[model samples]
Target chain A: MNLYELTIGEAHGLLSRKEISAVELTRAVLARITEKDEKIGAYITVTEASALKQAALADERIAGGDMTPLTGIPLAIKDLICTKDIKTTCASAILENFIPPYDAAVMEKLNRAGAVLLGKANMDEFAMGSSTENSGFKITRNPWDPGRVPGGSSGGSAAAVAADLCLGSLGSDTGGSIRQPASHCGVVGMKPTYGRVSRFGLVAFASSLDQIGPLTKTVSDCALMMNAISGYDNRDSTSVPREVPDYTQSLTQGLKEVTIGIPRQYFETDGLDPSVFLAVQKAVKTLQDRGATLVDVSLPHTSYAVAVYYIVAPAEASSNLARYDGVKYGARDKTQSSLLGMYRQTRSKGFGKEVQRRIILGTYALSSGYYEAYYNKASQVRTLIMEDFNTAFKTCDVLLSPVTPSPAFKFGEKREDPLALYLSDIYTISANLAGIPGMSVPCGFSQEGLPVGLQILGPHFNETMLLKVAYNFEQATDFHKAKPVF
Target chain B: MKITREEVIHVARLARLELDETDIETFSHQIGTILEYFDTLNQVDTQGVKPTSHAIFLTNAFREDEIKPHLDREKAMANAPEKENGYFLVPRVIG
Candidate 1:
């Protein structure tokens, strides 16, 4: 197989054996991007010079006997994440040319791991939309269906992995940004337990809900990457104090008596796609046949997830984006003669329509007249949703569901219709609201031949247990083996 | 749940956006639909429960007012759209 197609596991084995140098692997990935990325639209900026320079250093270290699982591996970072010296755009015109002076905690973590960063991939502007259509840049298409959206926010990272443009990618999930794209692109996306990973360098969409996680070709790869980037970071006050575990160690152990819960509440008359339903059913059977107990559970307050998320996320966004005034940071369209004109002109030109819309709604929700009514009420609903998960997890180790109501839709299908777009993330957003870890793994394909994802969600920091079950299930199934024919 | 043009305009003002009449109606319809969909939250009962904002249980995470190593002035001003004499430049308000 080409280096681009090699799983992180295979590439690591080859690297350790001196079969492939990091520079060689990096060149192969860059070459593949040149050949294939035009159709995928997976990247906004490819830092070929910096990437090659990093790859060269990786080879030098490996030659001197220093190695990590990610050493020399080519990676695509979602543009919403900050990277030192690299233009850190939240896929918005405001930060179009803004470069951070410091690396994000994950960036520092990954660099120490010796990973070669390919460059920044595109996303929904300010992580605002359910589809990548909200990005100030061009649309990122699904590798599986060129005409369809690559789901979104983390859509570029997911597209990169699906198209084999990068070995793995880093994506931020404020709501369903990571998981939804992973579901649509037929890759693995892990939205870590909210505090599980630090948010020091991530561009905030929803302060409480935003998390940085890895998107990879397989669950095992995602787990490995998560291990590298997760753990305590003093720079991020929200970073958890829990001890980070080596996720790969327990992953191969088969699920013998683990209880995998099926939330029956998520399936009641919500107009879910029949294909996604079938795929999730098959996955449940696969888990059950592999000796895991199948438990029927209820997250009865689940339908409130989207409602809680939209209000809370926007409210947070409204505050976070206030830093982008023309006076201080980022780009400003300032031919305005007056100070107010400058602020108005700059912001109006900077943020995309979707981002502006959210900011407006959030500003009002948090305003004096309505703060208690809308934002506060939404927070209460959020509590109920998390409590539902808490109650469900008491009965079982993890919950299983479809990552999305349907697979990827046509590029323009949900662009004009915002509600239809929001509905696409119904199954995945709840985990974000609750601050839990969720994974979207390829399970099956629709009759239309597009891929579907079976979501596995677990309680906070139960990622090791979740990965064990996911890997065991993956080993028993061959769904992840399928690759797109571009 | 039914957000109006006035509501959109009011929110827009809070957000410091310069939207005209056309944008107000469009945003109202779009935001209205989204809010209506979220009205599903009204069905749930969140009685006497602590409003859970953060997923992981942690509190009092605010840091003390410590003067840490801030970025250099040149570094800070590197990305400023408009800068003047090591400061972020804006139209001077006071004469």
Candidate 2:
């Protein structure tokens, strides 16, 4: 196997045995990025020099017998996460030149684990869109088919992992940003329960819904990553003060006692592609054959998830994004004389059309006279949606569904229709709303050869159960083994 | 549910974003469509449902009043568009 194609586990084995040097592995991955990123557009910035330097230090740590599982593992970070001294653009022009003064909480953990940072992966501008097309930088293409989108917000991280540009990558999920793209790119992506991972230094989109997780080549690699990044930090008050179990410990074989809930509403969702439905059904049968019981469940509010998410996410985004007035950091309109003019011009010019739309939508929702009708109304519905999950989880250990309603769509397919794009996240948005852990594991491929992902969702802070189910399915199927022939 | 150009412009102003005539038209139509979709929520009878501002419930996370290491003046000012005397300089707010 090519050095760049090695999973984090495989590379660790090789590195520990001295079969491959850390520099050699990092150089191979960097070379792969240099070769493929131009066509894939998976990165906003490629930190070659810093990566090599980190790799050298990782080698020293390994030589001194002070290595963790991630030691010397080269990975890509979604651009939204802050990395000290590195340009963390969040794929927006406003912060195009903004370099953070401090590392994000997750970055501090990864750095301590001796993980090598390859670069900042591209993402949706402010993580506002379902397609990376909203990026102020570049659109990331699916490695499976260059004509299709890799999926948004975390598209670059998913594409980099799929194309072997990096062994594993970190992607943030606000509304299926990580899982959708991981599904599109044919990789394993997990969005841990909200607050299960710290959000400190994560460029906030919707503060209440956002969670940082991992996109990896395999389920076990995803487990390894979750172990390293999940923890509470006082800096982020929302981060839960709870024990994070070793996620890999849950990767046992059979699903004998596991009961997977199949939400009937999801299968009945309009526009769910037949191919996706078939693939997920086959995966359900595979689990059943593996000694798992399938229960028909109903999350009645599933239909309203897209509606509630649109209102709530945008409302939060508008408030959180108000910080970018170009006074302290990011782009400023020097031509404007008055403070108000500068604020208006800098934001108008810095933000893309989609971002501007969300800001307006959010501001309008929270505006006077409309707050009761829009934001507050949506929040109430959000409660109903959360209750739906709470009711369903009572009958099952985890819920199974399609990560996305369809396989990766071609670019420009739904670019003009914002509502259509929002509906694409229908299957995955409820997990964010309920603050439950959700993951996308490659199940099978469409007739078009695009990958389909089976989504496994568990109750809050129940990542171990989610991993066990996903790990068992991954072992039963070879769909994850099928890589895009880039 | 139909948002007018005037409403879009007003919301844009509230958001501190300056939009062109074309942007106003586009956003008005698009935002109107999205709001129309949001109308679905009104169908659910949420008479007494409490609003969920956060997913996972947690109390206010308070830390002891203690001074810890923080970013120094130089580092904080490094990304500032304009700065002088360790303070970020913005456009004149008053005459």
Candidate 3:
């Protein structure tokens, strides 16, 4: 296999044996990015100079007998995560030239692990849209098919991993941003339970819902990343104070005692593609053959997840995004004289169409006289959605479903219809609403050869259970090994 | 559930975003559809259901009241669009 194609585990083994240098691995990945990123549009910025420097430092660390699993592993970061001195644009023109003065909590951890930063991946502007098409920057194409989207708002990270542009990547999931794209790109992506990771220095899109996780070529790599990034920090008050267990320890083989819940509502969901249903059904049978029991469960309020998510996520986004008022960091409109005029102009010109649309929707929902009917109602229904999961988890260890209704759709297929794009996340959005962990593992491919991902969800802070099932399935199936022939 | 152009413009103003005539028309129609979809939530019986502003319930996270190092003035002002004497300079607000 090529150097760029090695998983984090494989590359670490090689680096630890002193067979290949960190600089060699970083250079190979950077060369792959330079060769393929133009066609893929997976990166917003490529940090070649800093990446090599970090790799050299990692080499020194490895030579001095101080190396972690991620030492010298090159990874892409979703553009929303703040990297000090690097231009961390959330794929928006508002912060196009903006540079952060401090690293995000995840970046600080990854840096301490001696990981090499390849670049910042692209995403939807402010992470508002389902497809990367909403990005103010370039569009990221699916590695499987260049005409289709790579999914968003973590499209770039997913695409980079799929195309061997990077070994693994960091992606933030608010409403299926990580899992949906990982499904589309045929990779493994996990969104830890809310508060499992610190949000400090992460460019906030929807503060209450957003959580950063990993997208990797393999489930073990995902676990490696989870081990490195999951922890509590005083800087982010929302960071949970609970102890993080060693996630890799849960990667056992058999699922003998595991009970997977099949949500009846998800199978009966409207617009679920037959191919996706068949693939997930086959995966269910495969787990059963591996000595796991399947139980029929019902998350009755699953249908309302999209509606609740649209209202709640956008409402939080409107409030969190109020910080960009032409005063501090990011773009400003100098042509306007008055403060209000400048604020209006800077925002009007800085934000893209979808972002502006969300801001308007969120403001209208939270407006006086309408709050009770819109925002409050949505939050109450959100409670029902969470309760649905809590009730279902009582009968099973994890819930299984298709990650998306179908595989990656062609660009512009759903771009014109915002409601359609919102509905695409019907399966994965509930995890974010309920603050539970969800993962997308490559299951099979459609007849058209597009990838299909099997989504596994577990209770809050139960990421270990989800990872075990995913790891077992991955070891049993070769779907993850099937790479997109670009 | 249908939002009119007037309401769209009103929300835009509240959001501190200036919308053009075309944008107002587009958003009016689009937001109306989304709001109509949101009307589905009313079907659920949530009479006394409490709202969940956050997924996890955690009390206020408090730290000891002590002076610790924070972002210095220069670093804080590094990304400011307009700065004067280590302060973010905005347009005149007291006029």
Query: Backbone clashes in each candidate structure, one number apiece?
Result: 0, 0, 0
B1-95: candidate 3 lDDT, tens digit per residue: 48988889888889999999999888888899999999999899999999998999899999999999788889888888999887889888897
- C-alpha RMSD by candidate, in order: 1.5, 0.8, 0.9
Per-model lDDT: 0.86, 0.93, 0.94
Candidate 2 recovers a fraction of native contacts equal to: 0.93
The deviation in Å at residue A434 for candidate 3 is 0.4
Docking class of 1: medium
What TM-score against the true fold does each predicted structure earn? 0.97, 0.99, 0.99
lDDT of 1: 0.86
How does the DockQ of candidate 2 come out?
A: 0.91
Candidate 3 local lDDT, A278-320, one digit each (tens): 9999999999898899999999999999999999998988998
Model 3: which residue pairs collide? none
Write candidate 2's Cα lDDT for A1-486 as tens digits. 799999999999999998998999999999998888899999999999999999999999999999999999999999999999999998888999999999999999999999999999999999988779999978899999999999987999999999999999999999999999999999999999999999999999999999999999999999999999999899999999999899998798579999999999999988899999999999999999999999999999988899989988999999999999999899999999999999999999999999999999999999999999999998998899999989998999999999998999998999888989998889988899889999999999999999999999999999999999999999989998998876
Candidates 1 and 3 compared: the better one by TM-score is 3
**What are the runs in model 3 whose C-alpha is more than 4 Å off?**
none
Q: What is candidate 2's CAPRI-style docking category based on DockQ?
A: high
